[model samples]
Target: MSHSTNLSHHSRRIDLDAPLHRKAGPMTHAMQPVESAGEAQTSQACPTPRYLTNSEAAAFLRLSPRTLEKQRVIGGGPRFHKFGRRVMYAVTDLEAWAGERSFETTFDPEYIDRHPGVQRDDQ
Candidate 1:
């Protein structure tokens, strides 16, 4: 089976049968905005909520879903909400949680104060 792929910036088509690495130049394609009827209807019905699921929140923070689950069980996780038995994380809460952990260095005195459970190597 052969497939035709369009190259960006150049008016040339590459065949799938050819060696991809050799024929396919820079893999950069500009994305075009698309609007569908469903999207319009949904927007008109209600504004989208800035909430993410456990997996999505984990991905946004570059953490594993298991880690988030553990944090939820133990402590020190971002603020979450329960909407009809569904756990959701707000974008603002995630941002605030991440912001709180920011420090200039590991040995910063504030780090020890914020995380009292942590043990410093020096100590």
Candidate 2:
């Protein structure tokens, strides 16, 4: 991981070699890096973790945006922060929320409800 200065007089450290391409696609012609709107939206940082938007968080949780929104409104979902009009979910918070929903039985949706002192996997 190499950090270099941007093309200016200033020597501020910035990583430019990080791949922003989302995924590699099948080549129909000469192989070229296919850049899309999604790729453009992604950050190119290596060591730093970025926040997830509503869509990104929903995708990360494998749920629909509407479902995540509903959970947020009802106050039983991953913790989130609001920056002006934008809603953001931290990666750690999302992971913790998902971990809390885990159970030994897949059929029991009310397992957490029935069991009282069951701690999360973190314990």
For each candidate, the alpha-carbon lDDT, in order, equals 0.77, 0.72
Q: Compared to the true structure, candidate 2 yields what TM-score?
A: 0.52
Kindly list the per-residue Cα lDDT of model 2 for residues 15-94, writing each as its tens digit: 65345433344222342334455754564534355588998788777789998899888978899999999999988798
Tens digits of lDDT, candidate 1, 9-122: 696776755445343432223221233468668867996657889987887788999999999999999999999988899888998999988999867989878876677544
- Highest lDDT among the candidates is held by which one? 1
Clashes of 2: 0
RMSD of each: 9.5, 15.7
Residue pairs with backbone atoms closer than 3 Å in model 1 (clashes): none
